[model samples]
Target: MSTLKNEVTAYLGNSSRIAEDWANYINHQDWTLEETIENLRQMNADEDVMVQVLMLDTMQGISTKSSEKTPDDYTVKYDGYYALNKMLSTFGNSENGSDVCITNSFTNYINGILSIGFAVKVQVTGVDGAREERERNG
Candidate 1:
């Protein structure tokens, strides 16, 4: 195994199932393993968090492989840049659950501080608008 692989395994712990994938992903990134690890640490990406992210990546990969099939409820669009920006933002400031307007600071952080090289389309579906009765009550 490579030094990066070994170091990542040690960091994530022996029990991590996705350690190999995580290590490979890190290795392929533009940043060094140390830089990646530092960024992950800043994000508080513990074993559980890393596992969840890896699982999300796996799901996204599966979705891409089966793109010919109709998208099921399990289908997901992976956008790491968007995810990291959201994580860096203050909780509930950027649309946490229901889609809402984003603050200027949030926008600046995502575009300026993060300097993400790519763009992502975040579609919010299933918003049928408030019921007539609910609207009248307001």
Candidate 2:
């Protein structure tokens, strides 16, 4: 009976170690948004994909709101706008690029999804600027 009890204890200990290793491996896996979207596409069909996209976008908005302002905000915003402008010019160039219709569609799609108000919130921190902008715009 003692030998059997010892064997059972050893088995349980090994099982616990295996579970811990599995959890660690899962935690260390690098995940990306594109891979996640592809996985969802494989798992779900039709309207489920749209639902997942909307859910992700909403979660992004919430996560963006949970962060406090840092000094790097301006740098990031400048880089983003600069890259966007470059892309627009490259893709929309009349002489050697795609037509305006495609560019306009892409622009509208980007504008529809991007929250300019959220950008303003992140870039404008002071109470005075926020109040003035609200008063002047609204």
Candidate 3:
């Protein structure tokens, strides 16, 4: 990628400003470049990343979930941050910054120890294909 374009894409990652810019850019008479299009597509992809996880046992499927406060240590496996945040909204009502990401590869421990049932793989997508895809490549 060109330095200028890459820098632009990096700066505009998933930002609403990108949408505005695209709206204006697409309106212009000039034809858009393919590289820019692809870059924009990548920037808006499912950027759901993982937190500190050690082991991941994959069967097949993508499930979304978060753990309730339990007597034992709570682990969270989430599909997307939006879904996870929505589920966690009522439970703890505690303050947690965005860095606390959960992934499907492994079980995630909650901040405190509690009696959690620990249900895994509640994928909003219906199929836990993302986990299977990652596991297959590795």
Candidate 1, pairs of clashing residues: none
**Top TM-score: which candidate number?**
2
Per-model TM-score versus the true fold = 0.20, 0.23, 0.16
CA lDDT for candidate 1 = 0.28
Between prediction 1 and prediction 2, the one with superior lDDT is 1
Task: Write the residue-wise lDDT of candidate 3 on 4-122 in tens digits.
Answer: 99885564453324343443333332322222233334444444321111112312222121234453332343344343334333222323311112222333333322221211111
lDDT of each: 0.28, 0.26, 0.28
- In order of lDDT, best first, we have 3, 1, 2
Off by over 4 Å in 1: 1-14, 42-44, 47-138
Better of 1 and 3 by lDDT: 3
> What order do you get sorting by TM-score, best first?
2, 1, 3
Give the runs in model 2 whose Cα sits over 4 Å from its true position: 31-138
Best by lDDT: 3
